[model samples]
Target: MRILLHICCAPCSLTVVRTLQDMGHEVTGLYYNPNIHPVGEYLRRRDTLRQFQEQMGIKVLYKDNEYDPQIYFKEIAFREANRCFHCYRIRLERTLFIAKRGRFDAYTTSLLYSKFQKHDVIADLGRDLAGGGQVGFFYHDFREGWKEGIEQSKAMGMYRQDYCGCLYSDFERRKKLLSE
Candidate 1:
């Protein structure tokens, strides 16, 4: 099957990409994270993904020239308590649309590879968004390979980010650090 993988960052994509390829699926990637705060951090992830694509020989479509965090904030406005839902929704919604537009057999996200991510939430959202089966939602529990992904990414010298990318997450991370 031709699958479009939503890549949040290069580190997360390591295991996700290998698993898809090993299963003999033709994989293409999409980097559409507007949730990443501070343009510098966003660029670092994007550049690392570019390097990964070249090394892994996967075709990845970048909407980097179209990065806009304000749109992201607006999408999650007044829904701070439910920010994760909105964050995952926006990125996955775009991936779903792009998959339909590109005529892909299915779509999945590397977000599933993050140990910190809400896996069940993302899976449920993906399934719900796959409505009418216009394009399939391929759900894989990529967290199983979390250790391997981290090891491989570090071995490959990828930039590993600490936070989940949203401003709220960043604040929470700093708050935890201050408490420590």
Candidate 2:
């Protein structure tokens, strides 16, 4: 299957892309994370993903116009408490749209690689987006290789972010630290 993998960042992409390749899927990366907040963090993730693409010899599609944080903010407007669903919705929707456009056999997301992210939410969103339509959603429990991705990314000297990449998430992360 030719897969269009939605990459959240370089570190997370490590295992997912490898796993997809190992499964005999031709993988192309799609970098479209409008949910990532703060321009600098977003740019850092994008740049690191670019480097990962170069080193891993994978083709990555960048949608700079969709990188606007405002799109994310608007998506979650007045619904900050359940922002994860909305965030995943926007990303997976975009990925499926691009998957159809690019004629990919299936689409998956590096978001599944993160222990911090809600797997059920992401999987449901992906399935809902695909809807047995022109494109298919590849669902895998990528968290199994979370440690491997961390170790390899560390070896590669990639910038691993502590937060989940949104202003609310940043605040929540800081809150946990302050409470601790």
Best prediction by TM-score: 1
| Residues 49-161 of candidate 1: C-alpha lDDT, one tens digit per residue | 99779788799999987699987999999989999999999999999999999999999999999989899999999999998787999998989999988999999998999
lDDT of 1: 0.92
Clashes per candidate (backbone, < 3 Å): 0, 0
Candidate 2 residue spans exceeding 4 A from truth: 176-180
Per-model lDDT: 0.92, 0.89
Model 1 vs. true fold: TM:
0.95
Model 1 segments beyond 4 Å from truth?
176-180
Clashing pairs in 2: none
Distance from true position, residue 42, model 1, in Å? 0.6
Clashing pairs for model 1 are none
